[model samples]
Target: MRIVVTGGMGDLGSRVVRLLVEQGHEAVPASRRTGLDLTTGAGLEAALAGADALVHCADDPSQGDFVTVYGTRRLADAAAARGVHLVHVSIVGIDDHPMAYYRRKLRAEQGIQAAGGPATVLRATQFHSLTAFFARTLTKGPVTFTVGDTAFQPVDTDFVAARLAELALGPRPTAYARATDVAGPDVLSLVEVARLVRAHRGASAPRAIRVPPVGRLMHAYAESRTVPPPGSADVGGRTFAEWLATQPARLTGR
Candidate 1:
């Protein structure tokens, strides 16, 4: 099968491409770097010309809805016209989230459904690196400030990528359908996460300070909106600590 992965050079997309290749599939990366620009629809038709499936990992939250929403719609339409299966990765708990990027992601899902094509949307929790970044950011010297009961159930990037590859290789859906949400095996509180991060760098655990949820966004996080409900997701991935151990002591951006 010939699979085209948008943003294939990215951290996630690159992994998808590599796995697809390892599985004996023709994997082509389509991105601005490869002469394919989703925002402008440049090289889109050509990219999907002989593609049996397309994995959409290309998103630009910074560009507002132009790419995240409209760009996705354009790609969906093109894939639909070509009868190519479209696999899109989305975040968990975006149905009523207040975050702008999550809203756009939801809108992108809607667009794919509206295109009336064979598509699969896979929702996964935050990546381990992102979770670590959050832990680092919220920690101040020897203290970590967190909202009411804020916690994260971050998933492994490789795990998510492998699932995307499986979907692309499996039977094409008849229409827009959602795959089971994927997440990590354990849920850790913000403070616990901070402790793990500090310990990764041989630093002492920070004192935890819990504050009110305050505001809709913080409240949403405080309620653990990012985590899927009990028994509501397919949980399989390296634990946060396991993933952290493989990373550099000094963590960088997500």
Candidate 2:
């Protein structure tokens, strides 16, 4: 399989590239670093030529319109033209979520499906690093200012990347495949997550302020609206605590 991974240098995409290569596939990293600017379609023609599949991981959540929505549509079209299979990565609850970022992700999904190509969309829950970062970042001297009651199903990026590689390398005989989801083994409260961070990082036990949800976006998280459904695929064997145990003892530098 000749796979072109957009944003292949990114955290998740880089792992995808490495695994694909280790499995005897040619993993071409298509990103700004490789002279393929997805936002403006620069260097796409040469990069995508003869590619068997495209793993769409390049996203700019801050610039959702120009970079994510429009950019993804462009990538889909190019892949369609080149007879390449397109596998799109997305979040679990973006379809009905209230956040602007989620709305954009929904648009990107819709646009890619209609953009004329063989496509598969894989929506995943929050990454462990993202959920844990709340604890990792908020633990100032003694106070960890955070939204107290929010819950998260934090999956490992390595698991997410493995699933993507499978989809990218698998057969795509149709114009579009039904979207699937993947999640972590367990869900944890924000405060519980904070405790784990404090224990591992050797940070001061935070004064832990329990601020209630204020906005629709925050409220959505509090209610577990972004978690995967009951029947969705759960691909990891390691729990959050187990994974955390193997991480570096030093706190990640903020």
State which candidate has the highest lDDT: 1
Model 1 worst lDDT run, 10 consecutive residues: 212-221
Superposed Cα deviation of residue 183, candidate 2 (Å): 0.9
Tell me how far the alpha carbon of residue 129 in candidate 2 is from the true structure, in angstroms, after superposition: 0.9
Per-residue lDDT of model 2, residues 139-189, tens digit only? 566666666466778888889899999999887958867556888898887
Q: What is the TM-score of each candidate against the true structure?
A: 0.99, 0.91
lDDT of 1 by residue, 205-228 (tens): 999999888789998989999999
RMSD in order of candidates: 0.7, 2.1
- Regions more than 4 Å wrong, model 2: 138-148, 203-208
lDDT of 1: 0.95
